[model samples]
Target: MSCMKTAENVCSTGIRIKDKKLTWKRSWQKYKYLYFLILPGLVYLIIFRYIPMYGLAIAFQDFTVFGGVFGSPFAGLKNFKTLMSNTLFWQAFVNTIRISGLKLIFAFPAPIVFALLLNEIFHPKYRRVVQTISYLPHFVSWVVLAGLLDVFINSSNGVLIMLLKSLKFNPPNIMTSNTWFVPMLIVTDIYKNVGYSSIVYLAAISSIDLGLYESAVIDGASRFRQVWHITIPSMLPIICILLIFNLGNILDGGFSQIFVLYNSLVYRTADIIDTYVYRVGIVSSDYSIGAAAQFFKSLIGMFLIIGANYTVRLFDQKGLW
Candidate 1:
């Protein structure tokens, strides 16, 4: 009787497993096209993002081109220790924090404010024209934009310099000046990205129920009050999500922009982790140190993302979890 009961239970479990497989197979068949649509993106992420993560192990090893990642001798935390002791690395780290913080404080909100202002515009044509003009800069390559900036602000022959000279005002060489380099970076970054970034906020704003605004109007709430109470509150989730994402990228510090714009004269102000890593890793061929820097940056970014998400959750706000 015991043996018979055991056989019956095994049979039932087997049947349940088969049923689940069949259900999964049917669902896959139904949504095969959707899966197919995402396959390319999945492949790209796997190939470019996930596969490259394996190379990060080099940070723990004395990596050499001929020795390769597998053949490299393990150094454990030696590279990271070296990085910590290096004054240049610390300077770059501090500069990255300062520049990224400045951008977060100033550039991050430019898009939101721009989007809100645009939403208030009654003229659709004019709004589109403004958006198009603003977005055009984002499509321009940083290399090209940097060159344009150099020309436009050239201390000797720049259009800005000429204009300032006309007014009997001396215009400093902004591109080389440590005092102006960071501010220039922030302003240019905001100018380039504000339009593209605002699109998400605009979409968020559009999804807000018009009935809320109408109800507010009926309650004699002013436009500012309605926006403050309804629009901002409605967009808070997205805003929080974006803020968390930005926090994760705190160390990035606009590598492409800085690389193209900065020279030795401005490295004091403009040098960042990415640029420093590129110089140490690729240019200097110190692969382990470079990898260590990147690994450190990634670690900090992960902690920041987790911290930001937890902080948001504490406020009873939705996070990227």
Candidate 2:
């Protein structure tokens, strides 16, 4: 009897599995076109993102170019240990945190505020003009923007310096000054990205139901109150999602912009993990240490994303998961 019962259960499970496969097959057939559309992206991710992950193993090895990944001797945690003990690495790590934190504080909110202000503009043509003007900076490459900044801030004949000199006020070379480097980075980053970043918030705002605003108006709610209660609440999910993404990238201190703008004079305030890795890994050929640093950053980012998602869940909100 027991043997017969086990055989029946096994047969039932097999039937269920077969049914699931058939269901999935039908669903795939129904959405085959949609799947085909995403195939290129999937292939790109597999090639660029997933495939490169294999090289991360070198972080645990000595990772000499001549020896290659497989030929390199396993160094265990030695690379990580060296990374931790290195003063320059620690300085770069601190600078990364400070710069990223400042950007989060200032640059992150600028977009949301700009989006809100843009939404308040009643004239469509004027609003579009403002948006176009704002967005143009985002399309400009960092290299070009940095060059423009240098031209405007150059001590000898810069537009800004000339203006200051006309007023008989001497201005420091902001690009090279350690004191001004970080502030310049923060301000310029905000300027470059605020318009582009606001696009997501604008999308979120647009998705909000018009009926909510109508209902708020019926209740005699002021514009500010309506926006406070209706617009903000509706956008919270998107905001949370973006916030989580930003938290995960807390260590990425605008590598391209900083690389284009920074010099040896301001290295104290300007050096960050990405630049450090580029110098040490590609420039000085210290691949193991660089890989270890990158691995550590990736681990931290993963944890931060997980933690942010968990926090969102605790608040009874939807998360990326």
Q: Estimate every model's Cα lDDT from 0 to 1.
A: 0.91, 0.89
* Prediction RMSDs, each to the true structure: 7.5, 7.1
For model 1, how does the per-residue alpha-carbon lDDT over 79-185 read when each residue is reduced to its tens digit? 99999999999999999999999999999999999999999998999988998898989999998888888788888898888999999998889988999989999
Off by over 4 Å in 1: 1-47
Candidate 1 matches the true fold with a TM-score of 0.87
Model 2 clashing residue pairs (backbone): none
In candidate 1, position 6 carries an lDDT of 56
Top candidate when judged by lDDT against the true structure: 1
Deviation in Å, model 2, residue 247 alpha carbon: 0.5
Candidate 2 residue lDDT tens string, 221-274: 999998899988888888888888888899899999999999888888899999
